[model samples]
Target: MKQIGVLLSKNYKLLSVAAILEVFETVNKFYATAGDELPFELNLLASHETIENQKESFGYQLQSIKDVKQLDLILIPAFTSDNMHETLQANRLCVPHLISQYNNGASIGTFCTGAFLLGASGLLNGKIATTHVDASDGFAIAFPEVNLKADRTVTQDGRLYTSGGATSSFHLLLHLVQEFCGNEMAIKIAKVFAIDMDRDKQSYFSTFQPSRNHNDELVASAQQKIESNYHDVTTIEELIKDIPSSRRNIVRRFKQVTGITPIEYLQQTRIAAAKKLLERTGQQMTEIIFNSGYSDPKAFRKVFKKSVGMTPSQYREKFQVR
Candidate 1:
């Protein structure tokens, strides 16, 4: 069994810690039955036993971690702070013990602003990590040694796993559980949580947001329309007309901001919409495809499999109308 450690700090947001705790605890319950065996062990690590309260966002207290050495995976939960020093104080032991843990082959992980603490620890030098977009500048200025990718929800460099924000913590944990336990357990947990079960290491991060500018206003407008009306049947030419920009300019700026062409983005959005419909509606595959802006069943199946690792029928069988 993999030994998991959650490093709780003073002022750490309650939901972040609670979410991680609840998920893992539920996983542990799977093993309580006579025929089931769990794949993980978890512990909460804190610097002190002074009866500290959790961060304001969620109301909870945490257990102190007395022995950091035996942990197989160490997770740092997100906390909000404008001042970097204040954030560090609650979980400062992470910095002093990180290198030693790495040398001994322990996996390091974090969620949201937890990446900021990893950066300060000097353990993330040259590693790819992500934090909240607002923390991007401060993280870069504080830890130029680490390569920060502001847009991603989760990034891994070797054994280090860093996540972006609050909700993304579920994705990060599920990914780790998948890595250590198996895909079956991941699917079971996801179904229990009513999650789409489509997330992977790369599937969940938001790449970039289209910026508003005079030159890119038309492109931004088109993107906004697409997002707002993802269920609507929108073609490339129609999108350009709505934006009032030339096809060339719209494509250029849209790709510049979001790292994909306009058509690609539309297809992605449609697939996302289809996933939601699959979870929420009892619609047939053909109807779901049409509603998600696809005209051909074969083509929709191909695209769904390519983007989400499962065919429409397979997705429905596994997750929808269940």
Candidate 2:
């Protein structure tokens, strides 16, 4: 049997851990019903020792990470919250154990913000990874050495795997199922879970929510300009025209504060507007483009496809309000 260890780390989102257990349990049940021996030994790896005294197995064996020396697979669940700085600090002791398991050829997969903990282990350095689309900015800022593929629904580098936010975890779970249990088993589980296994990208679900976590009024001023006039302003200069700072200085502070340049902020704002129009109304392409501050249809389509991972028509078809 494959030894599957799901880290019941502190601050772990309960739903994520439950989902992981549910999938593996279903896998085991599938084999057992076919009169085959159980295929997986699902173990919840807890950081503390108190779990051993508890009797809430729910069909999963809880083992202290300190006692477990080997595992074939390790699944890290999303955190209960997005404050990864504190979340990682609380789960610091699990990192060394993860690194050891990974080095010993065990595959590691993370769901949503759980990638932060995996990234903290330095295992993702130079490896392609992703987290929640909204949290992508923070993840990129925190782990500059890692290749952050924010648009990808699921990414696999060697044995390390990462997924996008929320429901994106289901896609990665299916992927791991397919990898170990074959395509047929994965598809069966997908049908049971009602997951769209063909979803290749998570970019369409993204919103351009600009950060207001910084104290720089100049940056806030630049953001105000971008948000208020994104439908008309075409240049970063226009967004900063009234701000009392040099372009270079504002650009640096903007990147430092918002994790994106003023130009990108404006582009995203325009995109957000366009997405809203497409979703809420049956707006024509040219009209939407102009209203989104773009005059060139071809340029806008290129940018839309590049950023949103789908053409405007496709996005509309998928998400248009009926």
Candidate 3:
């Protein structure tokens, strides 16, 4: 049987850990029912024997029987923290252990913000990975060496795997089951857990939050204006009118600071506004396009699909309020 370890740390999201264990356990039961040999020996491992549950009251605790070693696969669940830098410092001890495990030929997979912990291990350097879309900016700034694909829900680079946000963990686990077991087992588990088997990206659910954490006051002001006036059909020239910089210089600095060009940022802002209307309103297509500052229907449809990975009507159908 393959040895699998789920590492639980302080402040870890308990539900993610539970979901991983439940999927594997349910698969094992399926194996038994079919008279097949057991495929996994799952264990809860940790850096310490017992850790306080950060999300709960003082009475709750998590106990682990295995240390971070000698496992065929190690899964790191997400943790809750507002400041990632401080959280990483607090959990820095797991880095060397994780590195040792990887060097010893064990595969590592992380869920949601747990990618932050894996990134801390320096193993994700130059590797394509993903985390919660809301945490993409923070992850990029913290580990610039890692390629953060915020749109993808799951990414696998050789033995290293990462999944995006919350229930995306279920998708990642299903992927591993399919890889190690078979499609039949994966499909069985999906039906057993009621998981959507087709979700592959988090782009549809991601909101475009503009990066304003830089010290560039002029660029910050320009961003604010773009967000507030996204429906005004404002041009880049008009955007830079209030700022004392050349168009070329402004575009250059905007890209440097936000990692996206001014026009791209404008498009994102407008699309984000459009998403809100699509989700919450019963407005027609023309009204949404106009309210989101687009005059051309063709241009709006093209940008919406390109940005959201779906058409406006599809997005609305999936997310619109009743």
Off by over 4 Å in 3: 49-68
lDDT of 3 by residue, 226-277 (tens): 8878788558777668888888898989887887788998998899999999
lDDT tens digits by residue: candidate 2, 1-322: 8999988888888899888889889998999999998978888788765485763455666788777869999999999876788899899988989999988889999999999999999999999999999899998889989999999999999999999998899999999899888999999999999999889899999987788877999898888888888887678887787788899999999998888888888888899999999999987888999999999999999999999999999999999999
Q: What is the lDDT of every predicted structure here? A: 0.72, 0.89, 0.85
Better of 1 and 2 by TM-score: 2
Deviating ranges (above 4 Å) for candidate 1: 49-69, 199-322
Q: Estimate each model's TM-score.
A: 0.58, 0.94, 0.90
Best by TM-score: 2
Stronger candidate by lDDT (2 vs 3) = 2
Instruction: Give one clash count per candidate, in the order shown.
Output: 2, 0, 0
Deviation (Å) of 300 in candidate 3: 1.6
Please give, for residues 1-322, the per-residue lDDT of candidate 1 as tens digits: 7877777666677788888888887888876663677766776667655435432222333445544446688888888565667778756765766666666888888888888777877789988998865565557667777888765656789999987676678878888778876898888888887755544333322233333433666666878877776666557776567566678987887776555677877887788788878877988777898899888888888888876666667666666655
Please give the ranking of all candidate structures by TM-score, highest first, separated by commas: 2, 3, 1
Worst 10-residue stretch by lDDT in candidate 2? 49-58
lDDT of 3: 0.85
Pairs that collide in candidate 3 are none
Sorting all predicted structures by lDDT, with the top scorer first, yields: 2, 3, 1
